[model samples]
Target: MFRVLVLILAFVANPSRAAAAPPDVDLELVLAVDTSGSIDIGEARVQRLGYLETLRHPDFINAVKSGYLGRIAIGYFEWGGKVNESSVVAWQVIEDAKDAEAFAAKLEARPIATRHGTSISSAIRFGTRLIETNAYFGARRILDLSGDGFNNTGLPIAVARNDALARGIVINGLVILIRPTVSTVPLERYYAECVIGGPGSFMIPVRNVEDFASAVRQKLLLEVGGLTPSLTAQPAAMHAPVDCRVGEKYPSFVEPAFRN
Candidate 1:
């Protein structure tokens, strides 16, 4: 009777300590997409549709099931100069096809809007915060960032990238090159040198709009399965290292209103 009273007292003193902890997930993935002025509505739509389809793909579903926990938590958000609350899709756990479809539907329903500036650093910082504060504990945390341009605003890309790496968060890149940018450095090289870091980190460049869907699906597969691509499939190494600050040197590229 005395031990029981002591236990009850402890529970009353620390209710949270007696409560169940957050669920464990195989991976915590934050999908940080660029909605800078450079991406027109059509291009944005393509990105949105590509992700929606990829989530429902059989290969991606299989990858999720192959995880040790058979589940992963994902959060989606669009970032430009800064992250807006309206652009964020709260974290969702995906363990099966139904969950994937529901999360994709939530993303598809959100209205797309492009904002000024290209701030990859802002996106990275925001993603890190989301991971740090999320309710699930994951075996691996990844920030999958997609962008058409470089980091022209906010903190330095290396700073944010390194900070995330220090927190054991892997950063991957999707370099969308369907449209041209003013920067002389190849976008892929820039991403390799500055934006992506941590173990198994890589960047995939989409040179054609037609390849966007496949590239996204392939990236999701590799990340979900925790596998790295072969050396031949990796981004080609450049003769000289890229200037990480090159984006800050050039003006932000804005798509013309008439262009699709």
Candidate 2:
């Protein structure tokens, strides 16, 4: 009994484990993709392919190399409910074509899975935590959110968005206007006013299926280079007034998988 107690005490006293120091990079980006039930399998496939192509695209690689450090850390995650944030790919350093190809290959190996609800706020919070714990120190940390619907579960998005902004983390959006006709409030407006924040934060709405690849490439360029795309030439409605709480009007039927 004394020997067992001594062993327990030793274990408690020396509980520390060595951890690698975080490396420095130009940017740390979390690609938070939506996998809510609203997005069908076909749509999900398109999104996956779009990201894979963007990762391997020459334009994106050039943008990455344009940075002073010529490298960036990136991670891919699928978000839906408060607890349904799944990591599709871990953080990877992209310094050249070979590194980018390896990252794309990892993404392609993951099985596409969908969750039950749309929790944009949860995604933001999850992404912020990821940035905090990653093995890289980025000059600019960014959360690139891509989603079709609005927040229907988890904490309020405004709170999460504000928290992230307060930490100097930029949150951008890729508003996939998959069902513009069905939604009363234009999603682009919702994303502009409520979703995105921090310096150089902006969103590009993809209205047509064919434009996904081009828009993604452009978005990646902006993100990697820390450049804000000019929105002055866009339609007035794209910057129109919005009700951030519009999504709250819907009944909450989905329970979070993380919270029992």
lDDT of 2 by residue, 1-260 (tens): 64344333223322221122223577889999888887778888888889999999998899999876789999988877643534558999999999999999999988887878888988988888887678776667899999888786777777788878766678999998866636687677788888998777899988877888888888989999879887677455434467777776343553333210
Q: Where does model 1 exceed 4 Å of error?
A: 1-23, 233-239, 249-260
Clashing pairs in 1: none
Q: 194-230, model 1: which lDDT tens digit per residue?
A: 9999878998888887887998999999999988777
> lDDT per model, in order?
0.82, 0.78
* Model 2 poorest 10 in a row by lDDT: 13-22
